[model samples]
Target: MSTALVLIMTPGLAFFYGGMVNKKNVISTMLQSIVCMVIITVLWGIFGFSLAFGESFHGFIGNPATYFMMKGMLGNATWKAAPTIPLLLFAMYQLKFAIITPALITGAFAERIRFNSYIIFLVLFSIFIFSPLAHCTWHPDGILAKLGVLDFAGGTVVHMSAGWAALASALYLKRRNEANHSPARITYVMIGTGLLWFGWFGFNAGSAFGANALAVTALATSTTASAAGGITWIFFDMLRGRKPSAMGTCIGAVVGLVAITPAAGFVTVPHSLAIGIISAVVSNLVVEWRTRTTIDDTLDVFPCHGVGGMVGMLLTGVFANQHVNAGNTTGNGLFFGETHLFLVQLLAMVGVSVFAFFGSLLLLKITDMISPLRVSAEDEELGLDISQHGEKL
Candidate 1:
């Protein structure tokens, strides 16, 4: 049940990203998101989940002890106040994280990559980069989790990792044809936004496991900030004399959603507002600034997910209120003036960004040995869907 929800959940991300690309690329766009579901799901079953959550090694990577489901999982609430779902169920849930992390990378290189190279890259990225980061950050006794960093769902594990990986992939892949001024599919994008907004409640609140008060709090805060983010973006667009485009509203809503994820369970409804506002500005600036550079992040993943993740992680430090979680014994926030936690949060963000950036670039360089990273220029001009898949939408 959980795994299915997890799988269904990421397709919404497809809509969110697809809508931002040109209609000519919309089908191809959705295909990338769907393809991630297929490739990552099989790999997760093969060994991705195992290497990530199976067993720890030196506070970094997992032992791959559970490879090919060779060993069974612990089956119960084996860790702290974590969920008590069956181990396989837990594995499946984590698989969603693995799949979606790669899916998020598409936002950076969408409408450009050779489907073959993209697939190979996803396979390599998960086994090498994503699995280890997840193991180190999310596993019980994991170094980052133990280091007092705040990430309720995946500010670091999913967003930062995907964002940085997207960065490396964007650089490694080089440019696509007419990559500039590639228009987005506003209708599909809006649909994706609504889907993301719906599914995100499951994403954030469900991280709580029992559907308790924290889940409620997370859901409420998630919605409040997304709404605020949409309005915030609209406020800016209107000021600039452009119509408050649907695309802008959805993007803003997404920024708000990303901003609130880490702090949802940690802070109150009011703190949610501050997080949404601050993150909206940062993400907006990043998307605008990064696009002007030579880097062709086909879809701007680094700015939205990467930058938004940092904002959320940092805000969690200032706004987190432990009174909300009497049971959350391992972590505490800087709210009520516990300023020390803020430094810890900053360190965690810096560490994640640096590690993801370097690690991703290394993976790209090594993978280049087996296959080229970018699509042929001819293929890019024709569109990835037709050139790669022999079908154009």
Candidate 2:
């Protein structure tokens, strides 16, 4: 059951992200999420697992000494936290995460990239960038984790890093396609929003590693925050004498979910609500502000996910109560008057963002040296759903 739940979570993200894109590109976008999951799973077993979970090296990346399948891993317990479950199970859970990290970047380059090239980029980026990152932030002896960066889940590892990388890819894809500039399809966006909310229960609460108090509390807080965020966006829309559109409500829900991810294990229901509302307003403002600039963040992944992740991480520091999570080393969080924790959270966020952005950029440039990253302008105009995959919308 533990093994099944972890692997399934990434595909759940597929429904969430696929539905948000234009109807024409639904399969194309979802394909990125799905394919990433599978490819990462294979890579994880072969080399990624060793590179990340093997012996610690200089507090940066792990060693590749544990190479090959079923060798060092057979029947032996080579893990921490949960030993009763097979080491393979724990490795798969982490593998699902590695797969999705770069898959999430696909959203940024949605309509323009060559499918074959993206497949290549996915494999390389997961190996070069994500494996090291997961090692740095997740392993028991990881530098950031050792320094007390409280991810709880993957606010930094998944959202912020993907967001930064997504932005870079979006820019690198070179603003192709007239179709993307068209008004987004709200109906499709709403469907994506619903799936994201449903899957997040597993995404956040499941991080507890069991069905227990902290898990239950996280589920409730995640649920409440999402609801309040949707309602808050509605309220904000009403204040302007306009009815809230489906897109607005969904973005609100997404922001809330993103904000709650980091703080889920630490804060109470009320804090989740506050963080949700604040996140909706802040992300809304960010989207509006970003549009005025030259950065063509195709799906606004950075503002909603990246910005929301940052908000949630900082809010975790602010609202975190060690009473809730015994693992939280900082006994008193920001709300309890320990302000330095917030700074630490920001520092951690910045570190991950910088690493993911540059690391992914280097990977893409290497891929580009071998093959063009984006589809031709003519193919993009014709639409990725049909051009890259050879399928109709």
Q: Write candidate 1's Cα lDDT for 1-393 as tens digits.
A: 435655775888888777777666677777878888889888888778778876688878877755565356554534333655566656667778888888888878787766777778788889887888888777786788777666777888888888888888888777766866646666777888887888788778877776589889988999998988888888877876879777888888988988888778878888898888888888888887887788888778888888888999898888888787664444456666677667878998999899888888887777677777667778777776677777755
Give each model a TM-score.
0.94, 0.92
Candidate 2 wrongly placed segments (more than 4 Å): 1-9, 74-78, 179-188, 240-242
Question: How big is the positional error of residue 379 in model 2, measured in Å on the Cα after superposition?
Answer: 0.5
Error of 1 at 106 (Å): 1.0
Question: TM-score of the candidate numbered 2?
Answer: 0.92
Local distance difference test, each candidate: 0.79, 0.77
- Number of the top-ranking candidate, with TM-score as the measure: 1
Candidate 2's residue-wise lDDT over 126-152, tens digit each?
Answer: 777777777777777788877788887
Count of steric clashes across candidates, in order: 2, 0
